[model samples]
Each structure stands twice: as structure tokens, then as C-alpha cells.
Target: MSSAAKRKLYLLKLSPEGNASLLGILQHPDGTVLKQLQPPPRGPREQEFYNKVYDSDCCDRILLELREYLPKYFGVWSPPTAPNDTYLKLEDVTRKFNKPCIMDVKIGQKSYDPYASAEKIQQQVSKYPLMEEIGFLVLGMRVYHVSSDSYETQNQHYGRSLTKETVKDGISKFFHSGYCLRKDVVAASIQKVEKILEWFEGQTQLNFYASSLLFVYEGSCQATTMRLSDVTLAEKRRVPKGLLSGGDVLEYNNNIHVINSTENGKIEASVGKGLSKFYALHKKSCSKRHHSQLSLKVENSEQDNVWKSSTCITQEHLNGNVLPQLEKVFYHMPAEPKESAKVEVRMIDFAHVFPSNTKDEGYIYGLKNLITVLQNILDN
Candidate 1:
């Protein structure tokens, strides 16, 4: 993560004060965070997850301790008159790590709909060949939007091609300020994810249909860890296999774009001179565009040009200083250092997760593929 002062703090929780769903950070005058969630209008997904899945009789009997693998669930919140307006509040896992860089990956295929109409399923299936040709698809990236800004601004910035953006928008903000996952942390995260999958095997009465894993990474050195979140998409199947009509198969979508990997590569390749060089390049490009747009008398959108065009470290220090210092720090480091990366991989986003009366092959196959991808990343 960049220096605390320069980092654009990302807040994903919705405040109890606001009726509308919001995705931005909220802080006290002294800088203390007040993270909370506001439920969606139509979905009882998260509520169902906590009531039926996490707190179920089946989970109590077979599942291991939840805290070891998951974040602490605080309980549900509801408004006075509106039964529909209910929110699920859980521990803000990002706060557990210093300078967290969070990433949310929606598991399964984009076109996948287990309950979709037959025609829709066929259409989605037909597109699989073309989708396979594309390496991995990133469904979404957690981004920082100003409090007064609408979702469109953030979405527009994120939707833009990564390499094409030059402004201090969402992508730039994340790369410039977010935590970068080091190799050790990545390995730890993979191992923890596998362990959780193994735990899933024990709950034969429950079939976990997960759609996403929100990975939260923290730390600057080899001493780091990743926290998983957002289990609203997971659920227990109606019945276990064998006695069931068909088994469940975990669908694997090869299109994955992890923020750590993407940003790390950019930093190593283009910003080796450190963040200052990248900032310099970005500022130069932005200034030129801004000046040209100024003469047109067009509306100067705040979202486009509002970010501070600066970095924590100077170019001289970044180029002539940092790496050698890090090398010296790790000179006598063990393969897995004593206080090495500590990753907490908890499966999240259980909204789409439900009981499947099918074989478990789909779910297992998808999970193994994900593990393989993580392993390959470490190997490379």
C-alpha cells in the first residue's frame, strides 16, 4: 500500500443513515472508520445465508468453528417499518490488516444460470468456445468513488481498458495507493483456500455453490496475509449426492484477473523506478489533456480530474534506494520466514449459492482449477 496519507480509502459498506445503497468510504473527523452495510432491495440472499446456511442445524453439527475460516458475523439489521429493508452486518475484514488491498472475484461463468430458462442456457453454452479463447474475464474490481459521486463515475473508470487509462481515476487510484500482494502472501492464500474446500467436503449434507471470493491482502513485507469475504452467494444443497437425482459440478471460468498480479506486474515492468515515475508520466499526460479540454469550455468532470497527481516517495529515493534496502532486509530470510505471510481464505458471496441435487463434480472441478491457477502463479 502507498503511504496512509496518499492512499484513497475505499469504503464498500452502506451506512444505516442512508436509504439508498452506497459504495464508498466513511470516516470520522479523527479518521476512524465507520463501516456498515445496506441491503439490496430485492434480495433476501445475504439474510438467508446467515439464517439458514451459517446458523443452520446442519452447520452446527458438522462444520468446524466458523471464525477460523470466516469473518465474524455481527448479525442482521432491519428498519422499523420496512421488513424488506434488512442488512447483514459482519466484521470489516479489511480493518484486520494494515493497508489492505481488496479484490472481489465472482466465481463461475458470467453466463452461468443453474435456474435459467432452457433457451438462455443454450445461448450461454454456445458462447463458451469464444469465451475460452479469452484467457480470463474479470467480473469486477472494487474501486473508490467520492461520496457525492454516483456509481456511473466509478463504473466508467473501471470499465475502461486498464492499459488505456491515464487519468487519476479508479484504476490509477488502486494501483497508486492499494496494497500489492507479494509472492509469499499469494502462496499462503492458495493453501488456505484449499483447506476451506477440504472442509466443504465434510458437509455432505450441504453443497456450497459459490460465485465469488473477496480476497483482502495486507502488509508490505513477506509478513502478510489475505482475508476472504462476501459469502452471500454460498448455500447448502437440498440433499447430498448418491440419493440425489444428479450431482453438482463446480463451473470453472478461466477468466480471472487478480488485482495483485496485475498491479505487481505493472510496477515491476513500468514503475521499477517507483511510483513517482508513474505519477510523473500520468501527470504529464493528464495535464496535456486537461489544458486542451479547458479551451473548449466543456464541463470539467470532477471524477476525471479530481485526484491528486502525486506519490508518497520521490523518484530519486525509489530508484537509488528501496530495492537494495529490501534485499538486505531479506538477506537471511528463510524459505517461509517465521512471521511470513498469514492468509485467511474464507469463501464469500453466497447469494448464488444454493442446494443442488446434482453431482459434486462441477463444484470440485471448478475449485481444483482455481487452486491450480493459484499454484501456477506461485510457480511462475
Candidate 2:
């Protein structure tokens, strides 16, 4: 038997709330199961199942009893939490290292049979929460194998329609965060199966927000695929349109071209002479045209510090000139310079104003000691 035939197969069963049950099937080189070990389950279960199985008072107790079975594949169990709680913590770990995480779900019919109505199975799996969380991010395929006993007797009787429905159901469930056996040939080796499962796990670790942001920047506008960055740059350079000498005209071919204020004595005519002409040309070129103008005047005042103020801009308005202007205004704000540094130091009150006070002095001295120790380590 070839080395590839000796790989392990995996079955990942995920509860509705995102807890996992992993079943690893070690396969012999001849495509036979060598051993099958159910992964220790994690997270809260139905009260009845918990009471009957572990006789534990709480979920944590059950987890403790099952601790020996964990850390066998994944290093530690990090249960799912709300986004804000998980983000910074996960960021801390991922900033220094990369790890693979796979996600899977189980699918079984009321008859305890692998083959079932595809549409029905899909509808059930679609309701799972984990499917909703990562649905847009992945595509899944189904693999099917029958129990040894059933495979021999039912092989000839199993119609192609059943196989097709099984495969379809499996894919639908897999897409909806559920897994089921399909008619597609299962990986001959258990190790190959485990590898596929691990691939999905790694995808789950990917930050969804970050990925979406990247997609927005990379995706095209309109039916035609054009680069977002290019569109933004073009918009930034667009010249405003206006009437020139009693006729509408376009002053610039693209936004990058600078309008000469005195090229044709055009500025003296109206509020937006050359710019209005540019807008007219733009309207003619694009399928849809809407024009609005905004003007702002700021008067210098010590009380009204525009430089330090924050402004709200919707994601749609974040491109073009607005983004660059905001960046320029905030360019000098104080920031931490080091990437590896943790714990930003800030005074609780006016420490500088009352430096000699006991509380202020104590804080200052404590900070000084902490910094000194950190500095010493770096120096050594």
C-alpha cells in the first residue's frame, strides 16, 4: 500500500453554538480504518445529555473531566466569544505566530442513515449559527462512505438519484456549517481527510473584518472590473464643471489636470465657471450624473481647535480627498512608536501639576521602576 493510502480520516461535529466534536480515523495503508477515536466534546450541551453522560453539575466540570482528551491536536481549547472580546486577544496571539484552525459540522438523519433528502438536510443545517458567521467566506464539498455492513448489501440497490441527493445535501450542509457523508468518494486515507479539515480550521482563524476591508479595496466598481485605487485617484483629480461664456464646457480631461486660474480669464465670470464646465463633461461621459457642492470656511480660534477634533465620515465617503485631508490633519498626533511594546502609559490625573503629592509621586515612581526594569532587559 502507498503512503497516501495510510492517511487518517476526520469527522468534525459542531454543535449549534459552535462547540466541536472531532473524530479521527486512523487508516491502514490498504484503505481500512486502523483506529477510531472520538474527539472530546467541548462547550455546553443539552441538560439531559449532560446529566446522563457526565453527571456533572456544570459545563466546566464536564470539560475538566475531558481535559485529558484535549490538547491532542489543537494546543488548547479557546472557546468562541463575542467579536470585541475575542479580537484583541486573538490579535495578541496571531501577531507573533500562525496556527491552523479547522471548523466542521455533523449531519445525520432521523433514521440513523447517511442517505437522506438533500433539501431537508440543507434546510436544517442552514439554521446553525456558525454557518451564518462564516457563510460568505467559504465553499464546501461533500464526501460519502457507507457503514461496512450496509455498503455490501445496499451497493447495488442504492440508485444514482440517492447518491446525487446525498452529495447535494452534504454540500449544502457543509456550506451551512454542517457536515454529512455524500456519494463523492471519501479520501482513501485518514491523514488526507484530517488535512482537509485542518484547512477549514485555518480559515476560521482569519479575521473576517480585515478580510472584508481588503476585498472592498480590491473589488471593482460597476459591471466592469476596474481597480478601486484607480477609481479613487481619478475622482480625487476630477475638475468641477460650470458654465463658461454662456455655454457649458468641460475644462479638464481628468482630475489630475490642474486648471489654470487665468488661462482664459474664466475665474471672473461666476462662482464655479471652469469647474461647472468640467462637471458638464463628466455628466456626459458617465451613465448617471448628480451634482452637489459643499464649501466650508474656518476661522482661527483658540477655543475651536479643528486640528485635534475628530469627524465622522461614512465608509462610502472615506475615499478620495476626504481621506487624505483627515490624514493630513491628524499627522502630528502623538502615537506609540514601537510595535512590540504593550501597555500604554497614561496618567490618571494631572500628575505633572501636583508632582510632589504622595499619590502622584507614587504613580510616577512606580512607572519609573517599571520602565527601568524593561529598559534593563533590553540593554542586557
Indicate which candidate wins on TM-score.
1
For model 2, state the Cα shift of residue 208 in Å.
Answer: 31
lDDT of each candidate versus the true structure: 0.36, 0.21
Give all candidate RMSDs, comma-separated.
20.5, 30.1
Per-residue accuracy of model 1 over 1-380 as CA lDDT, tens digit each: 22222222232322233121223223222223222343442146545655654563544644444345655555654334444433455554554443344454334434354665688667755644322222222333332111111111122123223321222132233322212214555666677778766765555544443345556554322211111222211122122211112322211111111111133232011112222222223223333211111011112225474221111222232233433222111111124622565444555555555555553444455556556666655565
Q: Estimated TM-score per prediction?
A: 0.50, 0.15
Which portions of model 2 miss their true places by more than 4 Å? Answer: 1-45, 56-97, 109-380
In model 2, the worst 10-residue window by lDDT is 210-219
Model 1 residue 201 CA deviation (Å) reads 3.7
Residue 374 of model 2, lDDT score: 27
Tell me the lDDT of model 1 at 248.
28
- Model 1 score (lDDT): 0.36
Q: Give the runs in model 1 whose Cα sits over 4 Å from its true position.
A: 1-42, 56-61, 64-68, 79-84, 109-111, 118-137, 141-181, 208-210, 222-334, 337-339, 357-359
Error of 2 at 86 (Å): 18
